[model samples]
Target chain A: MGLQQPSFSLTALAAVGLATAMLCAASTPAEAVPSFARQTGLACEACHTVFPELTPFGRRFKLNAFTLTTKQEISDINERKQGTLSLADLPPLALMFEASSTWQGKRVPDSNPSAPAGSQAQNGTVEFPQQLSLFYGGKIADHFGALFQVTYSQPSDHFTIDNSDIRYADQSQSGDFLYGLTLNNNPTVQDVWNSTPAWGLPSMTPPVGLAPAASPLIGKLGAQVAGAGVYGMYKDVFYLEGTVYHAALTGKTTPIDSTSGSHLDNYMPYWRAAYERQWGRHSAELGTYGTHAHFNQGGLNPENGLVMGADTFTDVAVDGQYQYIGENHIATAQASWTHENQTWQGLLNAGGTSNSKDNLNQYKVTGSYYYNRTYGGNVTYTRLSGSTDALLYPVGTSANGSPNSQWETFEVDYLPFLNTKVLLQYTLYQKFNGGSNAYDGVTNRKASDNNLVMLGLWTNF
Target chain B: MKKVFLAAVGLATVLAHAASAATESPPKLAREVCSKCHGPEGISQSPLFPRLAGQQAEYLDQQLHQFRDRSRGDPHAQAYMWGVAGPLTDAQIKSISEYYASRKPVHGAAPSDPALAAKGKEIFFNGLEARNVPACAGCHGEQAEGQGAIPRLAGQHADYLYRQLRDFRSELRENETMHANVQSMTDDDAAALTEYLASQ
Candidate 1:
């Protein structure tokens, strides 16, 4: 009775709020958005807080292999009614586009000598249709499904495979346990929740200057790695997973390229553990994940003669997320901390480092609130600090001998339609490269001068 | 910065007006027109009328469109929903479905026979495989808290469930898979199962 009391109260509150809104006729009309809604016949609210931020039900849908669908299907049946070749009659596809304009607080000093005078620096710049993306997501077979994404960057003028996660899953008799295997091209690409770096807050942002240079290596190692893992849930409460990753060379037919970053000394191993609880309108999750990798740094300098040493790194992270979904409002908060330990054996052997060990730590926290899923805002604070080494980190350029910096971002979003969003984001820098003033010693650039504001439009079909 | 602030305020005002216009449209139509048998919030007092509260919006909307087009030809649907859904515009149907989906479901009383309910629970969890019946939990959720377009069966009306299951078995309902699934189920089984589901 005690366990059920809160749920009843939550339902009552939601009913009151919904009834009031119904009487007031505050909801907008419905329109088709994407492949998921088209195939499942469910509205976006069943799965998303906004766009990619998932609700509890969304997490379940992904964990179940995304095979649940109401679309027309073709299949060959066996004795037990097993599907021989199950496929959707319609191919699930969607197109997405984004446009943005960026404004920096101060003009950046021309750092490139090849740049022309007029092309040097500006306070504002706009990219019409900054990015165009294609997505093929939904059930692929009876027990298999995938979410694949490809993007074309306007600045680069190139198309590349971005993120892909394919899965095969099954459930137990009583439906209390679910198990699955995943094959993904990125480290956290297969993650179902938004608390991780793969799908966290600020889902979209500009690749502007003054962004932090030193991010934890865990999130950076993706895109060039091929990873495989197995995961399972116990009664939908406890989850566990382990994966191994290998360097995968892209744009080449060969398995390894010595000149590319896709060269690995050994396979990296990653592990995850989480516990989730959902009751009433409140849901929470606490989890830990980590990865260990060793890279051969000899190929970094082919002219120096191939050295036999390697740089080893171990990154450990912990994260938490909490969400409250009322009838008219939704609130979410997420936090994560990562600590990376690196041993510069190859760099030390090459006379590039004075120390053998270095450590980098990063922390991020964000909170968001939405009203009627139409208008919302969020704030985020992020900090990065690491051991100082003058030899390892130069005193000039973007970094200043120390990997220490802090920044905060505030963003407001408006959704005129369910598939369209307009957002404004402002960033403030408190510290950069261990100094608040004259962080870039060469140009005497202050940390506060790097502040930026961006306006963005995102839409999907 | 000031320009940005002013633009935000102006956009907000326009959006507010747009939202107000929507309120005057479908929600008013839903409340004023469709609240006769289905209550304002979609909780029906009569057992003959199926409770629409907490049903999936997608499922509800699909059914309304089907009824208007004569695609769903079940006796009850033909007798009741045919007339009700005939004149509903697409916008009105969507709004009514959304309004009903947002309402809270009401749990009914327990079965008069607890032993029969226990047997029904067994059938719900572990289907009578010898009779070729699949577990209801496989499609509906563990607690019958449906997903996607599936309608929630927990706390549904016993009379409605019994009639639907019987109709499915007799080919009176047009669902082929459901007909196959319930063909092996007996009248006693359907009665017990409905009682158990209604009490959930």
Candidate 2:
């Protein structure tokens, strides 16, 4: 039983606010742009098992900074006969568009306070153009390349910088190893593995679907900061990378001020290490990555406007992937788990939370199978759990003030062309916001009420 | 005597430089570019790409020419090799072909099913009289070590071999001789042959 006769107006505002805030941190589907195919003169299959998942060759292509081009080039040489310039005759540019329709299991309560009893909002949503993106995704020089994207979402109605990575790479003279440097705005945007947060499974989701309230800071910060790092692969087996990040606030003043919400206090450090092995038609990879960050909570003292104390977050994760690519069938399984340690000293001092220390954990596993790169299906199971804080996760949204949720997603996809994909995805939630029934405490809403089914068409050219 | 010694040293230096320059590009290209997919020395680990090591030089040359000229209209040829071969000069192709052909060929892995291998061996060495199929070894050699412009089938990836046979039969590969030889071969027969060839 739940409090069904609560203040409808207040509950409606709180629900909308929570949903809107959560949407900003939800996963944005990763993409495999066609510019790389055009630049290298290779078909999409040469680099990907499907559009966004990498093959061994695709991983190597990214490791080389996407500069392996066979296209005609305009060239120049210096006086010493050292090459000074080499530019592709055709610019590496591409466009991607996605449209989708989403249906939720149950309609939400109407926001209008004067509405008749049992009135509900619409249960179905159609987004004509869920997202449209332009990409510059290939070589710029002999050893430098970039995958830069600008995207427009129907919800936002404005174009903004999306996931972008620019890199410079070269191989050792002995051809035994490769090393590169990357500058990117996202923590795992430069990663080559799908097991990483930036490219993980459930490649796409409805823009407005309900999501867990808490996630690791490492997975949440994308396009909000800039990072530079160096990575290397030895004998095509071992991989290692390290990077440091600083705030690159968007739509903000030149110099960050109090207006900017909680931001990186100074810099955050991120690192990754992985090992891969390939034999015959099989490949496997195991990896670990983590980040440590200190944040300025933006709480200022009233007297002098001096900044208050800071909060800290440390997140570490382990991931692995196994791929079997037969002549006609391709199968892949990947799993990742992340543990976060949070110390909200600043927020605690400001009375924003009931506890100064808490922890959260997320686990995900996905398995997929495809036949001849044409039709495929995947299943993903995700679980999230964290220590409860009454003030942090209040009663209306989280019945028990606990951040615990679990869900499973199943998706089937058909690709008529390598660049075009049609997908149907369904998500079932076993628990949300700490409970299955009356999860939100005030609305008599069940976790299953948020079950989502989405049909989408995505293509890039 | 001093003048003669100086002349001899200068001639030796010139010859050495010319020899190095003449042989450099192919190995560099092979190591840096082709090796990404084909693996070093063309012993590719993935069945999606074919092994080029120990292939007949003349065959490699002909294929490269076909790829560059868009005459090899197979799906894979159009998708992968056309753009790669387009920019190569004839000399570069010849040198690259020779470089791979000189490398040691791959050794076949043991077949998973010995019975399948045995059937394939029989077909490779003897004709299917009822089906009017010719013995593959008549042209591929007793050991499947092809000669001149014929391709070596021994130790090739089984999947690659099977697909090529299918393409030839379907005329997708546009090889009159190969199509004539494989047109009547059934999928089972092709599978057996690939198994046997892959096991050498």
Candidate 3:
């Protein structure tokens, strides 16, 4: 089953009626409550500039372990009431549903050229209800909390676990030092900022037929690994974290692919460092993160010597973010770049990849502005490029042999209720699979033909 | 391609104008909408109105929502905030709270009786076991800057605090926990406590 794509867009419109929104609750949760607001007894404004876009307080809330509570509690009395403990008092449970429609610039030709008469996708398709989700989000104990989500995608007709980040964190101050620990399941999922690949924009998007074909390895390890790390914020200025991740069984009971092995040969190391400062109305952050991983060439079969060997991949990323918050307006800018080095020795031995080594790169930047917290808009541009290997991508023309792609996204959002949002988004493609025109070569499909428009309603009770 | 870029730029310009027109500073909103009763910069001219300056933003936001939802039904709340909060959008509520939180606070007038003020300080820092009243500083900070969702109690108007304590004890205010805590306190106790907090 395919996972629900995090469709990142601006906030929704507010003037829409609740009854009308509920009737149109044909969509899934974008910024659902999931007990965080209720547990903290604060509104969304406390944590987000807009939904999923964190404010300074929101970042602190995450780093402090999501343990702040307003419910009745029983404290654990050690020598000095050491760590506060409260009941899972409030049911940390919530549900979300969504309905959506996609309008493409041109009709999608048949997937199989041999069967041109076969059914083809039209220019516009309406999903009665696109997605549904259940969330268990909030504090698990005094120093531990988790945001666990399970989603059901209507188009894929399947259920799967979605984005989840469980953390064990606690802070202690030694004059200028404040430090904490986090044990999580995903690489960038524990991050407080949206500039990270895992939680970054398009908070929600179509699960199929919309994204680019290639991405850095940093974007590929969400549900397939577990990690633990320690972080510290020095005088609330410099931040650092170092973690190691190991492969976890993915795809439920699906058999492991013997050729393109999905299991890891050894632990992957990830690290992040950043400097942040906030002065009055403005805040800015500049940071870098990187990871090194080695995966088995073939399936991790105990008896197979060839399968025991490994292929290595190393990924490095740098990112920055800035925000200016005012009573009447909020403005933000974010950018990130990722580069991946792939050594395909193991894969080539297993007869998987075409080359021994390949390099890939991804770059993205977005700017957003919100007026009166009621109306807002954003623009994003992204580019992806990689080393050329004909055997690796022999599907199309000479341009398609190169892994170069680019996309542009524009969105506007309106919020009538702080907790409710309506959005209209448009996306454009400059290049797809290395070609701006005749991308697929055989079907005569152009990258521009894939332009899409979407309207969505997102809310939580 | 050029046309699309130009069109996007045009849309952005229009949207930016809309943003500039739609937005207003929180301080401006506070002065125009809240200052009539709470006083300029949240220092109240009337004892009946609570001092709002330097109050916790979280507390103000919560109270505003409560008032809007009619969960806070004190006589004054019903008479004043019910109407004020009814028409406020969430952003307005946040702006108003943040504005007040950032405002400079002014101390209320000292009580005429020093002995009463001293007694109030005792109650403020130390709980009275005989009455099951917890120390005010246990939850509110020593100087009452507030933490998390708790409200700041320092340097507030004595009359307003006294009235609230009395209201809580008399069931005129609807806070279940606060009412229970104040139930056994006498009028003198309420008076002394308010004076002590105001002195801070």
Candidate 4:
């Protein structure tokens, strides 16, 4: 696909307002109702490069968690817990509240008494969660089952209702056609991997930060999958899902990044899709997704007082996962390309220079062993190369050069209980790029690397 | 056909139990050995052992079972419990489950900082950059909901919360990130935060 200019795209969108509304739901953060990222005893990494994808395990997880069983571990909640009931009592509503607290290296609170007893990592700092969510899962009719979740976060106490889907799921049905779809927002097969999205991974910066930056652009809590799309099963083995929607509204229409000025929103149209096949314990999946920025004439001005117009950005990726279950070993590999040659492409405004579609290619390979069961470990290496397109300026500089940078991560996950897990991870970063496009005043000269250690506990009811 | 089916059902139930049952060692001598301190079914009726009954199975597995030789080192939990915790291999320790898993979690002490939880809520959802504190949700969970190995901090006993925070700061409770996360908080913050969490 080819990229376009900014000002021109906006005029076209202005001419077609209602048409745009149907394509784009209001531009705020889309909150898919929060569902357990993993259903059953299935873990996140099983489906996604990280979590929440439909790897065989992930897909099976959904079937098992939501459809297969309604026998939840007994608790005090008064809501309906059964998955099967007569049509009169078919649709059910459920709710769960979860919270967390963690400590990291040198960041441990002054009050942590265990600080001394723990390894050096615990001597650091900690993080936690403040969240509330409501879930609604039931058979809307005979063949259709509904899955919807709404989550509320702290601070502004923003409430998001997203991650809603309606599926004509019949595991018994075989052939080239199976079933899944979204009435509002939807996630393609690719978004299953949290690390794949803009704010979800690599970086949260819009058009500008498309390159590299000093701070982490990745957020652990995943972004919601919304918009409109559908997914299905083929012969009970192959799987496919696709979605088209408006990306989360950056808020500031004036095309600037999260930190550019008062922090405006970024709006763009996008589509994503993926395909997968399961051959016994071994399986593979392939997917691609991209976004197009449409300049909204009625949008706000850029932080710098520039009349921010519409912009476009798109990313395509092919990933494969293979698992050796008998011995409990899993391996994965993926390559992604983000083409920024589109109108909204490039890091900061390319300083008004001749433009080339910004091209970024990145991938990772990881393998882990069960090491019996309670003790398991994995090692992975990832390299992300950003575009030198004029649009990617300021924040996108890699430490090694102006083109490529890399991060190596190693993690150990121990599941002591069927419901609980502990993950210890170490990440090494390498940035190798430098250039002044539109944002950063200085370009990096020497390659730099930082090491981070993360230890976390995750559980569910 | 019905008789055969019933027989098969009986067989299946037995088989399922055998498959999932934790590797049994010295069968939990609930009264003879455990009751000396932990009370029956590990409820700790004495208020000292901190009732273990009805606890999330995962939480119990982690505290008494995960750590090896260092298992009994926790200062907050009773020392005798630690001694018991030390010899537990994964399956052996699992033999001793809590009564709480099947029971409801009851409140311990009354709230002191009546508004503390509300204040803590402020910090939990939002970061306290002014106090150099990050938001609690960044790790624990949204709405105080605990995840897979992380304990459900919300709705826990305030006294237990205070003791845990104190133990973490003192290096008595050597869990994962909490050891470090707690290191930054002041005792007051921990207590206030605990009250906040408990109230939630």
Candidate 5:
């Protein structure tokens, strides 16, 4: 046997579907699902404005998406003789969904003996999906199409619609020159990376010095929607995008001035640019993203001896990826380094309230292999650290931001079925400083690790 | 010299034709084995059963592999498909996938109603922006011809579209990309987009 087909359990198909999406999925795109697009040998834009997002064509692909192998052929839209709309070329409203459930290895200590009594669970259990979504991908117009979708889960009732966007694209026969726009709503950087997505620093384990889940640094809710962005591709190689949006609700910001209750409320402007080049089986990209904001918060915390201050953080990253594409084998490795910084450390006293400014550095690497039906798997590792220690506010009052030495993670994906998969993973973290998660006395800080067992379903729709 | 070149070209054309004939769907696997449930030539008439004819080769390979590996969740179909899809090796999947994709789809008729088609087109081109509805043609294409991973939407089933849009708006579906787009859309947009897409 070349490789045992690895398939994970599919529990809580609703809740886990989203977790998998946050971890394994990359970038928010509007179009047919990635696996489906990959199967069709069609560029994502053929049906989507972005990856994992859908357009009209993307929606059609979903209707009858799963039964491709059984199909006879793709009818040419132009060849249809009698109908105003070519029935021969229409796609279906088929779809693919996945979910998984994970069991965490770490134990929850009994801080209060009288707390809600529960099982001292040791063996981890996970219920979520590798791909759980209800989608419609296909053509909606003579030329335009889309992927419309929504996902239902626990913790919230009303179904949340996402990954929906519209697109109009054009490409020459030679496959050069692609132009289009995507009208959509997506989370900001903070919201997009909320928690330690399997893709980001492990949310399972908090960094050294900082409290993991305990920190006020929870991921932001998605914002910055209701806008149109332009995307262009030259020679089917170089690519670019530009967009703008206003936040729905004014962000809750840190105090920026000593004056009680006086703050700056303004619409933040964000811009991101990236360049990618592929060589052989590898591709490399360099990118920079920036956002400028004038914050305004409530009155100063005079009781806590606090003053408001204006701040901004600009981030930049360098990334690279390589793919080993063979007739029967496929493998890929990708890595990136990101740096972030803010202004204002100088105004506040050393390790004082004004010292909230920070500079951080992060790095990640992941690899995946798909060897024809015999076997397939993927593994990824990431780390994040700080150039200068972050400051403490509400808690850990006198503590200084420690260098984030422990944002480490490891994950493994097993494809037991031909195209289906189950992934299991674990992560370790340490926050050696006195910020967020750390709150031991004045500098509440310590090292923490998390063992997560994830089992879920992954498939091509 | 020119006459000789023309003769050579003619010979090459004949040879190419021979090559085409030599490449055929695996003889053992025919419509008899697959069409019984999937419908003639792998296309389906039932709304629930997806049409399979005319899908791309890679797509077929990927799905077959997913099912065989058990990475996808479908216990309902597993009882029926497990044995058949499992025994096939990678090489077999590739060939079968190629053979099926190479076949063309049997044509069908367009919807008889023109009013729905016209209304759907309006939504496709110019969305209700005041209501924050975005146009569909902005990204997919003026003609709905997709590129790089996007699916083709020109022609599809109306019931399928309607079912999906409702699923999305109602949260029965949890899609990351389209979920947000649907969050603000009214039921009308979903209906309009569905009707338009199905008509396409």
Candidate 6:
């Protein structure tokens, strides 16, 4: 059967919207919650410079599968004196709340076409609880643990499974090497470093905002697939990991068929390698990671039985981080660059793209400084560029059939208590969707028109 | 007489069993859990964690007890130690303390600044008379090898020692003697003293 007409002919702008929504939803703020503190009997500083940004010790904590505990446990032993059951007296459960208000530089066009000839949506939006999440994190068994989250987003008004990483970890008898296996729902969700896409900078941003039309495939697949991998660290310096992913759609029938949304035709493979060095109060890491995937646009045509071919994407990235942790001052800097190559065989077969192959590159650099973990600020700059393909990035969103955008983000954070934070963030766009002005080709929209200011309160218990 | 003999035999067996249990579990716990941060032999790699090897058994025992009872109110103690010490038994604490104290002591790395080390050595041996600061060696040994209930300062990370001095001065650590000793000390004095002690 040939490719389905409706699925293949879906406007590039719609596809971009879907991708952007998924990326934004998936990048919700991750945390180092109080439950972990209760389990380990260690303070938040032991594992984090700030919430969500891990220290060397925190990285090790995750490498060990978050199984370290100082809490009392109910236990049992077998005839050979081997432990059979070990359950923490207190469950590792935590709840997080995020409330935010966002102001756009200019209001967007009202989406309701039946309204007046000229209309605009409200310029400011408030989410009483922008997002609420419940987490079950920490040791699940002797050498197994999990950090699982279920989130309720205000815009969606529903609870859905979020990022999750379950692991089985162990160390060598001589304690020279550490190794683990992970079953996670998202790429880089199991990674210890924030340089990776999943935990990268701009950690918190407004949920509803204008975003770039194109991103790497790896950045868009979070929570839509499942992966299993093995990872290891040698001498606490070198790290290596490999994972393979398959489609695992939520709220969808098992053994997916053509009716399922976009899904992998076969397992995607992801790999990572890194080297970290520590001396005194300074720590630095350099790493490279990549993924390759083949996806089938699932749908059936009235004439053509099914969409027949798969589109392939190969993504590779290099990242680095440097940190200086002092008694009263802490500083961190991170940078990353990603390259993606796309082959749209299935889409081209259905006349979806003007070009069969395209390429994209993204670069980001961020720096942050905090004093006593009480007050901090962060600055980040990001640039993304890709090949021009008319049918792939059509008019309405991309005037020049190109996906090029650049922006800078500035944020200031205040913490009155360890578990609570108040933050103000601003984003300024330089170029979006190929042009600074008339970017959408349908209206007099300027790249700067999408600028955003957001203020938020985040806390967990 | 026969009943008395039987009772004595039973008591001796019980004592032996308790001794064996005490000896066996502490090492396992030390290796499996404590070693994650404090290093396998109690010489920690991170300055965030203090080296435990060759510390005074009495000091270690006293501190663990304080942590368990929530009396040691330092930020790190509250964050990291309270939970760990919460579940520890008296015997476990005693065994763990002795286990760490018996290990080989750490040899401090060379001081980053020799001048600072020299100044610190002076402050260690002789009181900072102008500032009314007492000599550190008076209570800690002349070699900085501390006595009972006094922490050994030699070979500890300079960063760790400096923070501890700050904590003591602020009374966050809540030790009357330590607070009195460090209250008059300035930042420069703390830097110098920690440098010298770390180079020991």
Give RMSD to native, each candidate.
19.7, 8.8, 17.1, 22.6, 23.4, 9.7
Q: Write the per-residue lDDT of candidate 3 for residues A25-108, one digit (tens) a residue.
A: 122224445478766655666568887788776786777677655455545657775655666656778776666677877765
lDDT per residue for candidate 4 within A1-461, as digits (tens), equals 01111222222221121112112211112222223322211223323322222344345424322332222322232367633432322235545433333222122112232434322222333333334456675444434456676766442267665355555443221112334444443333223432243213211001100212311111111132235444444433444444444433332332344323221124333444556554334455565555443423232344434344433334445544454432234444444444333343222342322353445555656555564345666666666555453323212222222345565656676767433446776655455334222112222222332244556554433
- The CA lDDT at A118 in model 4 is 24
In model 4 chain A, where is the ten-residue run with the lowest total lDDT? A202-211
Superposed by TM-score, candidate 2 places the C-alpha of residue A272 at a distance from the truth, in angstroms, of 1.2
State the lDDT of candidate 1 residue by residue for A320-375, as single tens digits: 99988765688999999999898877767765555789888999999999997899
Looking at candidate 1 chain A, the ten consecutive residues that score lowest on lDDT are A1-10
Clashes of each: 1, 0, 25, 123, 161, 3
Which residue ranges in model 3 land beyond 4 Å of their true spot?
A1-34, A74-85, A111-119, A173-176, A253-261, A297-309, A350-352, A397-399, B1-200
DockQ of each: 0.02, 0.20, 0.02, 0.01, 0.01, 0.19
Candidate 1, superposed: residue stretches over 4 Å from native: A1-33, A78-80, A115-119, A303-308, A398-400, B1-200
- Per-residue C-alpha lDDT of model 1 across residues B1-200, encoded as one tens digit per residue: 34433443453344334323322222644443344335445665434467788888998998889888878887767655665577668997888889888888888677778999888888888888888888888888898877767778888877778888988998877778888999999989888888888888
Which residue ranges in model 4 land beyond 4 Å of their true spot? A1-66, A69-125, A130-141, A146-176, A184-186, A189-211, A214-225, A237-240, A247-277, A287-308, A327-340, A344-356, A389-391, A395-403, A432-449, B1-200
Candidates 1 and 2, the one with greater lDDT = 2
Residue A239, candidate 4: alpha-carbon lDDT: 47
* True-structure lDDT of candidate 1: 0.70
Model 2 docking category = incorrect
Candidate 6: deviation at residue A416, Å?
1.4
Model 2 reproduced share of reference interface contacts:
0.35
lDDT of 6 by residue, B125-162 (tens): 99799888899899899989999999899999888999
Model 2: colliding residue pairs: none
lDDT of 2 by residue, B48-166 (tens): 88999999999999999999999998888988898788888899899889988998898798999889999999999996777767899999999898998899999999989998999
Q: What does the interface RMSD come to for each candidate?
A: 21.7, 13.6, 19.5, 20.9, 18.6, 16.5
Model 4: iRMSD? 20.9
Give TM-scores for every candidate, taking all chains together and pairing residue i with residue i: 0.67, 0.90, 0.65, 0.46, 0.47, 0.91
* Candidate 6 lDDT by residue in tens digits, A311-363: 88899999999999887899999999999998987778767678889899999
Evaluation by DockQ, superior candidate among 1 and 6: 6
